[model samples]
Target: MATRPIRMFGDPVLRTRAQEVTEFDAALEHLIDDMLETMDEAGGVGLAANQVGVTKRVFVYDCSHIEEGLRGHIVNPVWEAIGEETQIDQEGCLSIPGVQKDTERFQTVKVSGQDKDGNPVSMVASGLMARCIQHETDHLDGILFLKRLSPELRKEAMAELRNAEWNQEPRG
Candidate 1:
Protein backbone atom coordinates (compact mmCIF):
# COMPACT_ATOMS: atom_id res chain seq x y z
CA MET A 1 0.00 0.00 0.00
CA ALA A 2 1.09 3.57 -0.66
CA THR A 3 0.16 6.91 0.79
CA ARG A 4 -1.83 9.01 -1.66
CA PRO A 5 -1.73 12.78 -1.93
CA ILE A 6 -4.46 14.46 0.10
CA ARG A 7 -6.77 16.83 -1.77
CA MET A 8 -6.77 20.22 -0.08
CA PHE A 9 -9.49 22.80 0.34
CA GLY A 10 -10.76 24.34 -2.95
CA ASP A 11 -10.32 20.99 -4.68
CA PRO A 12 -13.55 20.03 -6.40
CA VAL A 13 -13.27 16.42 -5.31
CA LEU A 14 -13.39 17.50 -1.68
CA ARG A 15 -16.58 19.45 -2.31
CA THR A 16 -18.45 16.70 -4.17
CA ARG A 17 -20.36 13.95 -2.45
CA ALA A 18 -18.53 10.71 -2.90
CA GLN A 19 -20.19 7.83 -4.74
CA GLU A 20 -21.04 4.56 -3.03
CA VAL A 21 -18.57 1.75 -3.14
CA THR A 22 -20.04 -1.10 -5.23
CA GLU A 23 -17.23 -3.38 -6.33
CA PHE A 24 -15.82 -5.28 -3.41
CA ASP A 25 -12.63 -6.47 -5.01
CA ALA A 26 -8.88 -6.35 -4.75
CA ALA A 27 -8.86 -2.81 -6.05
CA LEU A 28 -11.12 -1.64 -3.23
CA GLU A 29 -8.97 -3.48 -0.73
CA HIS A 30 -5.86 -1.81 -2.11
CA LEU A 31 -7.53 1.60 -1.95
CA ILE A 32 -8.45 1.05 1.70
CA ASP A 33 -4.91 0.01 2.50
CA ASP A 34 -3.59 3.10 0.82
CA MET A 35 -6.04 5.27 2.73
CA LEU A 36 -4.96 3.86 6.06
CA GLU A 37 -1.37 4.42 5.12
CA THR A 38 -2.12 7.97 4.05
CA MET A 39 -3.98 8.67 7.27
CA ASP A 40 -1.09 7.47 9.37
CA GLU A 41 1.42 9.35 7.28
CA ALA A 42 -0.54 12.58 7.67
CA GLY A 43 -1.11 12.04 11.41
CA GLY A 44 -4.86 12.16 11.01
CA VAL A 45 -7.20 10.15 13.17
CA GLY A 46 -9.45 9.34 10.21
CA LEU A 47 -9.74 9.85 6.46
CA ALA A 48 -12.38 9.54 3.76
CA ALA A 49 -12.02 8.55 0.12
CA ASN A 50 -12.89 12.07 -0.99
CA GLN A 51 -9.94 13.41 0.99
CA VAL A 52 -7.72 11.30 -1.19
CA GLY A 53 -9.40 12.62 -4.37
CA VAL A 54 -11.45 9.46 -4.91
CA THR A 55 -15.19 9.97 -5.17
CA LYS A 56 -16.16 6.84 -3.25
CA ARG A 57 -18.03 6.38 0.02
CA VAL A 58 -15.23 4.82 2.04
CA PHE A 59 -13.29 5.88 5.11
CA VAL A 60 -10.75 4.57 7.60
CA TYR A 61 -10.09 5.47 11.20
CA ASP A 62 -7.45 4.66 13.79
CA CYS A 63 -8.58 6.23 17.02
CA SER A 64 -6.58 3.92 19.24
CA HIS A 65 -7.16 5.70 22.54
CA ILE A 66 -10.69 4.42 22.95
CA GLU A 67 -11.75 1.32 24.94
CA GLU A 68 -10.39 -1.28 22.56
CA GLY A 69 -8.93 1.15 20.03
CA LEU A 70 -11.33 1.46 17.11
CA ARG A 71 -9.51 0.81 13.85
CA GLY A 72 -11.19 -0.22 10.63
CA HIS A 73 -12.18 0.58 7.07
CA ILE A 74 -15.84 1.28 6.37
CA VAL A 75 -17.43 1.37 2.94
CA ASN A 76 -20.86 2.77 1.95
CA PRO A 77 -21.49 3.69 5.56
CA VAL A 78 -24.57 5.17 7.19
CA TRP A 79 -24.52 6.73 10.65
CA GLU A 80 -26.86 8.23 13.23
CA ALA A 81 -26.38 10.40 16.25
CA ILE A 82 -27.34 8.30 19.24
CA GLY A 83 -27.92 10.86 22.01
CA GLU A 84 -28.87 14.47 22.61
CA GLU A 85 -25.71 15.09 24.56
CA THR A 86 -23.29 17.06 22.42
CA GLN A 87 -19.60 17.70 22.68
CA ILE A 88 -17.71 20.68 21.38
CA ASP A 89 -14.15 19.76 20.62
CA GLN A 90 -11.24 20.80 18.50
CA GLU A 91 -11.12 19.08 15.17
CA GLY A 92 -8.76 19.09 12.19
CA CYS A 93 -8.70 17.59 8.72
CA LEU A 94 -6.08 16.11 6.46
CA SER A 95 -7.49 17.92 3.45
CA ILE A 96 -7.44 21.31 5.19
CA PRO A 97 -4.00 21.29 6.68
CA GLY A 98 -2.88 23.79 9.35
CA VAL A 99 -6.38 24.64 10.45
CA GLN A 100 -8.28 23.50 13.51
CA LYS A 101 -11.70 24.53 14.75
CA ASP A 102 -13.94 23.90 17.67
CA THR A 103 -16.85 21.92 16.30
CA GLU A 104 -19.97 20.52 17.92
CA ARG A 105 -20.68 16.84 17.35
CA PHE A 106 -22.66 14.01 18.77
CA GLN A 107 -21.18 12.49 21.89
CA THR A 108 -22.13 9.02 20.68
CA VAL A 109 -22.71 7.53 17.26
CA LYS A 110 -23.85 4.28 15.67
CA VAL A 111 -22.42 3.59 12.23
CA SER A 112 -23.28 0.74 9.90
CA GLY A 113 -21.68 -0.09 6.62
CA GLN A 114 -19.74 -2.72 4.69
CA ASP A 115 -16.30 -4.14 5.04
CA LYS A 116 -13.83 -4.30 2.19
CA ASP A 117 -15.37 -7.58 1.06
CA GLY A 118 -18.92 -6.09 1.15
CA ASN A 119 -19.92 -7.90 4.32
CA PRO A 120 -22.02 -5.91 6.75
CA VAL A 121 -20.14 -3.88 9.35
CA SER A 122 -21.38 -1.87 12.28
CA MET A 123 -20.08 -0.05 15.35
CA VAL A 124 -21.33 1.93 18.33
CA ALA A 125 -18.73 4.52 19.15
CA SER A 126 -18.37 7.12 21.88
CA GLY A 127 -15.90 9.85 22.89
CA LEU A 128 -13.15 10.58 20.43
CA MET A 129 -14.06 7.62 18.29
CA ALA A 130 -17.54 9.00 17.83
CA ARG A 131 -16.20 12.40 16.89
CA CYS A 132 -13.76 10.87 14.45
CA ILE A 133 -16.49 8.85 12.77
CA GLN A 134 -18.67 11.92 12.40
CA HIS A 135 -15.85 14.01 11.03
CA GLU A 136 -14.86 11.46 8.43
CA THR A 137 -18.44 10.75 7.48
CA ASP A 138 -18.93 14.45 6.90
CA HIS A 139 -16.13 14.30 4.36
CA LEU A 140 -17.99 11.60 2.48
CA ASP A 141 -20.93 13.97 2.31
CA GLY A 142 -18.76 16.82 1.02
CA ILE A 143 -19.11 18.75 4.28
CA LEU A 144 -15.96 20.14 5.74
CA PHE A 145 -15.52 20.72 9.44
CA LEU A 146 -15.18 24.40 8.69
CA LYS A 147 -18.79 24.45 7.57
CA ARG A 148 -19.86 23.25 10.98
CA LEU A 149 -18.41 26.32 12.63
CA SER A 150 -20.20 29.60 13.13
CA PRO A 151 -20.24 32.20 10.37
CA GLU A 152 -17.42 34.20 11.89
CA LEU A 153 -15.35 31.12 12.55
CA ARG A 154 -16.00 29.86 9.04
CA LYS A 155 -14.84 33.16 7.61
CA GLU A 156 -11.69 32.97 9.69
CA ALA A 157 -11.11 29.42 8.54
CA MET A 158 -11.44 30.44 4.92
CA ALA A 159 -8.98 33.24 5.42
CA GLU A 160 -6.52 30.84 7.00
CA LEU A 161 -6.92 28.46 4.09
CA ARG A 162 -6.37 31.20 1.58
CA ASN A 163 -3.20 32.37 3.26
CA ALA A 164 -1.62 29.00 3.91
CA GLU A 165 0.75 27.55 1.35
CA TRP A 166 -0.93 24.29 0.48
CA ASN A 167 1.18 21.68 -1.23
CA GLN A 168 -0.45 22.03 -4.62
CA GLU A 169 2.29 20.42 -6.69
CA PRO A 170 0.94 17.70 -8.95
CA ARG A 171 1.13 14.17 -7.61
CA GLY A 172 1.90 11.33 -9.92
Candidate 2:
Protein backbone atom coordinates (compact mmCIF):
# COMPACT_ATOMS: atom_id res chain seq x y z
CA MET A 1 0.00 0.00 0.00
CA ALA A 2 1.22 3.48 -0.83
CA THR A 3 1.27 6.17 1.83
CA ARG A 4 -0.90 9.15 0.98
CA PRO A 5 0.22 12.65 1.88
CA ILE A 6 -1.53 13.81 5.03
CA ARG A 7 -3.64 16.93 4.58
CA MET A 8 -2.25 19.59 6.89
CA PHE A 9 -4.30 21.60 9.36
CA GLY A 10 -4.94 24.53 7.00
CA ASP A 11 -6.51 22.38 4.31
CA PRO A 12 -10.24 22.99 3.93
CA VAL A 13 -10.89 19.26 3.49
CA LEU A 14 -9.67 18.77 7.05
CA ARG A 15 -12.53 20.89 8.30
CA THR A 16 -15.28 19.32 6.22
CA ARG A 17 -17.42 16.70 7.82
CA ALA A 18 -16.73 13.37 6.21
CA GLN A 19 -19.34 11.50 4.21
CA GLU A 20 -20.36 8.11 5.45
CA VAL A 21 -19.07 5.09 3.59
CA THR A 22 -22.06 3.40 1.96
CA GLU A 23 -20.28 0.87 -0.22
CA PHE A 24 -17.84 -1.73 1.00
CA ASP A 25 -15.77 -2.47 -2.07
CA ALA A 26 -12.21 -2.74 -3.34
CA ALA A 27 -11.71 1.01 -3.23
CA LEU A 28 -12.74 1.14 0.40
CA GLU A 29 -10.34 -1.66 1.20
CA HIS A 30 -7.54 0.10 -0.64
CA LEU A 31 -8.19 3.35 1.16
CA ILE A 32 -8.05 1.59 4.49
CA ASP A 33 -4.78 -0.07 3.55
CA ASP A 34 -3.26 3.21 2.47
CA MET A 35 -4.47 4.86 5.64
CA LEU A 36 -2.81 2.20 7.72
CA GLU A 37 0.41 2.70 5.81
CA THR A 38 0.22 6.45 6.21
CA MET A 39 -0.45 6.19 9.92
CA ASP A 40 2.42 3.80 10.35
CA GLU A 41 4.71 6.02 8.35
CA ALA A 42 3.80 9.02 10.45
CA GLY A 43 4.10 7.09 13.74
CA GLY A 44 0.65 8.03 14.91
CA VAL A 45 -1.78 5.86 16.81
CA GLY A 46 -4.75 6.95 14.71
CA LEU A 47 -5.41 8.44 11.28
CA ALA A 48 -8.68 9.88 10.00
CA ALA A 49 -10.05 9.96 6.44
CA ASN A 50 -10.07 13.76 6.42
CA GLN A 51 -6.45 13.78 7.48
CA VAL A 52 -5.72 12.02 4.21
CA GLY A 53 -7.99 14.29 2.10
CA VAL A 54 -10.80 11.70 1.81
CA THR A 55 -14.08 13.01 3.12
CA LYS A 56 -15.22 9.54 4.15
CA ARG A 57 -16.31 8.75 7.67
CA VAL A 58 -13.46 6.37 8.34
CA PHE A 59 -10.43 6.12 10.61
CA VAL A 60 -7.77 3.52 11.37
CA TYR A 61 -6.12 3.16 14.74
CA ASP A 62 -3.53 1.03 16.49
CA CYS A 63 -4.18 1.16 20.21
CA SER A 64 -2.39 -2.01 21.17
CA HIS A 65 -1.79 -0.65 24.64
CA ILE A 66 -5.44 -1.10 25.52
CA GLU A 67 -5.91 -4.49 23.90
CA GLU A 68 -2.95 -6.55 22.79
CA GLY A 69 -4.51 -7.42 19.43
CA LEU A 70 -6.71 -4.34 19.19
CA ARG A 71 -6.14 -2.44 15.95
CA GLY A 72 -8.38 -1.82 12.93
CA HIS A 73 -10.50 0.60 10.96
CA ILE A 74 -13.86 2.09 11.90
CA VAL A 75 -16.22 3.25 9.16
CA ASN A 76 -19.17 5.53 9.86
CA PRO A 77 -18.36 5.47 13.56
CA VAL A 78 -20.53 6.72 16.39
CA TRP A 79 -19.24 7.06 19.95
CA GLU A 80 -20.71 7.85 23.35
CA ALA A 81 -19.28 8.90 26.64
CA ILE A 82 -19.28 6.00 29.03
CA GLY A 83 -19.27 7.86 32.34
CA GLU A 84 -19.07 11.23 34.00
CA GLU A 85 -15.42 10.79 34.63
CA THR A 86 -13.14 12.91 32.45
CA GLN A 87 -9.44 13.42 32.13
CA ILE A 88 -7.16 16.05 30.76
CA ASP A 89 -4.36 14.73 28.65
CA GLN A 90 -1.83 15.99 26.18
CA GLU A 91 -2.71 15.19 22.59
CA GLY A 92 -1.13 15.71 19.20
CA CYS A 93 -2.74 15.28 15.81
CA LEU A 94 -1.42 13.99 12.53
CA SER A 95 -3.00 16.84 10.59
CA ILE A 96 -1.80 19.54 12.99
CA PRO A 97 1.69 18.30 13.50
CA GLY A 98 4.31 19.57 15.95
CA VAL A 99 1.75 20.78 18.45
CA GLN A 100 0.63 19.12 21.61
CA LYS A 101 -1.70 20.52 24.21
CA ASP A 102 -3.76 19.46 27.15
CA THR A 103 -7.30 18.59 26.21
CA GLU A 104 -10.16 17.20 28.24
CA ARG A 105 -11.79 13.95 27.16
CA PHE A 106 -13.90 11.18 28.57
CA GLN A 107 -12.14 8.57 30.63
CA THR A 108 -14.09 5.80 28.93
CA VAL A 109 -16.14 5.54 25.80
CA LYS A 110 -18.15 3.05 23.79
CA VAL A 111 -17.69 3.37 20.06
CA SER A 112 -19.50 1.39 17.39
CA GLY A 113 -19.26 1.35 13.64
CA GLN A 114 -18.90 -0.81 10.58
CA ASP A 115 -15.71 -2.24 9.20
CA LYS A 116 -14.31 -1.67 5.74
CA ASP A 117 -16.37 -4.63 4.53
CA GLY A 118 -19.54 -3.24 6.12
CA ASN A 119 -19.25 -5.62 9.04
CA PRO A 120 -20.39 -4.25 12.41
CA VAL A 121 -17.66 -3.09 14.79
CA SER A 122 -17.87 -2.22 18.48
CA MET A 123 -15.50 -1.55 21.34
CA VAL A 124 -15.33 -0.03 24.82
CA ALA A 125 -12.12 1.83 25.41
CA SER A 126 -10.38 3.81 28.12
CA GLY A 127 -7.07 5.58 28.73
CA LEU A 128 -5.09 6.27 25.60
CA MET A 129 -7.36 4.23 23.38
CA ALA A 130 -10.43 6.12 24.48
CA ARG A 131 -8.65 9.39 23.86
CA CYS A 132 -7.54 8.22 20.43
CA ILE A 133 -11.04 7.12 19.42
CA GLN A 134 -12.37 10.48 20.50
CA HIS A 135 -9.63 12.36 18.71
CA GLU A 136 -10.12 10.58 15.41
CA THR A 137 -13.89 10.83 15.68
CA ASP A 138 -13.56 14.59 15.95
CA HIS A 139 -11.72 14.62 12.64
CA LEU A 140 -14.65 12.82 11.04
CA ASP A 141 -16.91 15.56 12.38
CA GLY A 142 -14.71 18.38 11.07
CA ILE A 143 -13.41 19.27 14.53
CA LEU A 144 -9.77 19.54 15.37
CA PHE A 145 -8.21 18.89 18.72
CA LEU A 146 -6.96 22.46 18.70
CA LYS A 147 -10.56 23.57 18.90
CA ARG A 148 -10.97 21.58 22.07
CA LEU A 149 -8.27 23.51 23.84
CA SER A 150 -9.08 26.27 26.26
CA PRO A 151 -9.61 29.73 24.80
CA GLU A 152 -6.20 30.89 25.91
CA LEU A 153 -4.56 27.71 24.76
CA ARG A 154 -6.33 27.83 21.42
CA LYS A 155 -5.04 31.32 20.80
CA GLU A 156 -1.55 30.17 21.60
CA ALA A 157 -1.93 27.16 19.32
CA MET A 158 -3.18 29.34 16.48
CA ALA A 159 -0.11 31.50 16.75
CA GLU A 160 2.16 28.48 16.65
CA LEU A 161 0.28 26.93 13.76
CA ARG A 162 0.65 30.08 11.73
CA ASN A 163 4.41 29.92 12.02
CA ALA A 164 4.74 26.17 11.64
CA GLU A 165 6.31 24.97 8.44
CA TRP A 166 3.76 22.21 8.01
CA ASN A 167 0.92 24.70 8.30
CA GLN A 168 1.41 25.77 4.68
CA GLU A 169 -1.55 25.25 2.39
CA PRO A 170 -1.50 22.75 -0.48
CA ARG A 171 0.01 20.14 1.80
CA GLY A 172 3.20 18.60 0.58
Q: Against the unseen true structure, what C-alpha lDDT does each candidate score?
A: 0.90, 0.92
Model 1 over residues 49-144: C-alpha lDDT tens digits?
A: 999889999999998755655788899989999979999988889888898988889999999999999999999888898998899888999999
**Candidate 2's residue-wise lDDT over 1-172, tens digit each?**
9999999877899889999899999999999999999999999999999999999999999987667977889999999999889989999998888889999999999999999889998999898999999999999999999989999989988998898986656856
TM-score, cand. 1? 0.93
Q: Pick the candidate with the highest TM-score.
A: 2
User: Considering every candidate listed, which one attains the maximal lDDT?
Assistant: 2
> Can you give the TM-score per candidate against the true fold?
0.93, 0.95
In angstroms, give how far residue 36 of model 2 lies from its true place.
0.3
Superposed model 1: Cα runs more than 4 Å off: 167-172
